[model samples]
Target: MNYVSKMLGAPDISVTLARAAARRVYGHSNRTNPRAVPTSHRYRVEEVPPALPRALFDTHFAPLTERLPSVTYEMQRYLRRAASLRLAELISGGTWRQCATALAIPENSARQTLNVLGRAFAPDSLWPIFENVVDHIAQELDESDARVDYVKRRRLMAQWHLPADHHYAMCQDLRKLRTLREQSNPSPIEVLVWSAVTEAEYLHSPILRALRLSAEGGGRSLTLSIHRLVRPTSPVGGSLRLRPTD
Candidate 1:
């Protein structure tokens, strides 16, 4: 969708104006601009609350399995893998990581393994669990580098004249989310967004990228879901998809 369309759907004029102001700064000459320029208005996903992994497994993944036998089997595989990983983490801190007493595995190796799992065996949904042993296995919740990186990105956005509130509003969500994995607790919203966006190669806006998630089935056409957060009041989502590849 076009920028005007994205603005038109904003909750209010203030948000729309904030978005506009930020866009203007990002629209500067790409060659001269050091910051990444969003080529489109990225989808904004809704926020989810934090919850335990077993609770998440039941709430998020268990239901889908009921609808199809194939789904059930696939989910079972993911659970077993999670159980094994959790055990490994508990017993030896996972295959890549060191024992609880020593330094952990290289971030590169851990990230590579996460990437392989995500693209292939990563379940369509996850069972969020907090056991102190495997909570960190998910990796999305322990994003110190990502968080710091976005801080710099947001600073550039503001330095070029973007509204502080607009950026802060986003940072608040990111801050809350990055910390969710310490307990292996995640809201359904978090699982959904993480499943869709973790391996995305490109996004229109780096800070705003989590708001947009890439959706598709294995061997299925892709779709882009854009949404607004329901805020402290509730999570009755308002959704739009742009040029869905149906």
Candidate 2:
């Protein structure tokens, strides 16, 4: 799927252009020569509402843990083993910080433990829930320290149960969504909504019922078209070869 082909085929581009757009946004070396670059043309599509992103987050991303019981349970196991505390306690005020301070586990030791735990159990999908937890932890940290804390929590999650390349795929999806927004003339919020709904559908998320109802009330064809535009051709993380062999 080349960029031109994607632009021609659908009003909303797929990951190919998304990656290119990401490079354009984040990888450009010549900021002084902003005019040197060529921008994507706008397509006059249906207006995406401004409130879409918030609606999608509330509808799809927030309650992600509820859809994956097994993953949640595995997460609980790792949290307990790492902190010797329940999930609630780990999330409780000052407790996680205290645990981290008390253990003072070296990065190497933490990595090894995560690898061992990740290999101990195989779950169908882990990254989403892992990411959710990291975001949750980052919420408590200062903006300046949030990135550092996010990295630490991300490492812990990846070491514990995340499948290889899962994070990469997730990152690509985010970049793709951003790219799609840039290339199109839709509202930023609407682009987020499109990304969220398509992602929810791809994940078989619990919000499908809500989406279906929304579609039924609105128009079925529009929903179908939206799916065609942004839905991933491949599974988000590819094959989940989670279990390790001796």
Candidate 3:
């Protein structure tokens, strides 16, 4: 089972159908088998915070019986508060320091923070923390070039390798740049940051990489995971196994 499914107590999927479905849905990928299940109108259900609707399991019923027997930690570090707490507990020693490190919070506040997290009844408060934690993990992942906010023009210019005299030209071009930014529909800041941070080559910083992963499926992954954790057990079984593609 994948980390998301395992964490949610979702049953394993059928390998053949999962593979065929992924290929059909996403086209063939040489790197690995495609594994993301689509959230089409056929699978759509009314979703509220912290509940995995029965429709999800019912709709995807055909391919979830057999086990896929593997897990991924890359996305595990990016789970919701409760799942993250569960993960922290599962880590070696399960110390406050360990939990602190995992949650990207200060060691002193680790125990208190976890206590609060453990008892948090509402999902609203936890989401922001998840974003902040992921950014911290991204910063931690990249050890060599320290990550810092490049919000200022001087810093942005240095990052973008722009000549001092080009500031006015670039500012003027912002109007024309609107069309380019519209292609991806990225935020103004995102476009500005991307242009500055990634000069010629797309050398994404750790935070940007984390942001990209977090933005997958329009932030549906985290929401799904949250819903999964809220209702962790399911008796339903089916016949397909799925794994994430590169």
Which prediction has the highest lDDT against the true structure? 2
The lDDT values for all models are 0.29, 0.31, 0.30
**TM-score of each candidate structure, all chains considered together:** 0.18, 0.21, 0.20
Question: Of models 2 and 3, which has the larger lDDT?
Answer: 2
Q: Is candidate 1 or candidate 3 better by TM-score?
A: 3
Q: Which residue pairs collide in model 1, if any?
A: 43-211, 43-212, 44-211, 45-211, 53-128, 53-129
Residues 158-244, model 2: lDDT tens digits: 223223254434435465434533443322224223333322111121123234466455334334433434333452431111111
lDDT of 3 at 93: 23
The residue-by-residue lDDT of candidate 1 on 1-246, one tens digit each, is: 245444533445353353334323222211111111222211111111111134334544443345333543234434433333333333332232221112112334333433433343323322222222233333333432322222233334422322445434534646533333232222323323432332111112332333334352221111122222222224331211211100
Q: Model 1 reaches what TM-score against the true structure? A: 0.18
Q: Where does model 3 exceed 4 Å of error?
A: 1-79, 108-112, 121-246
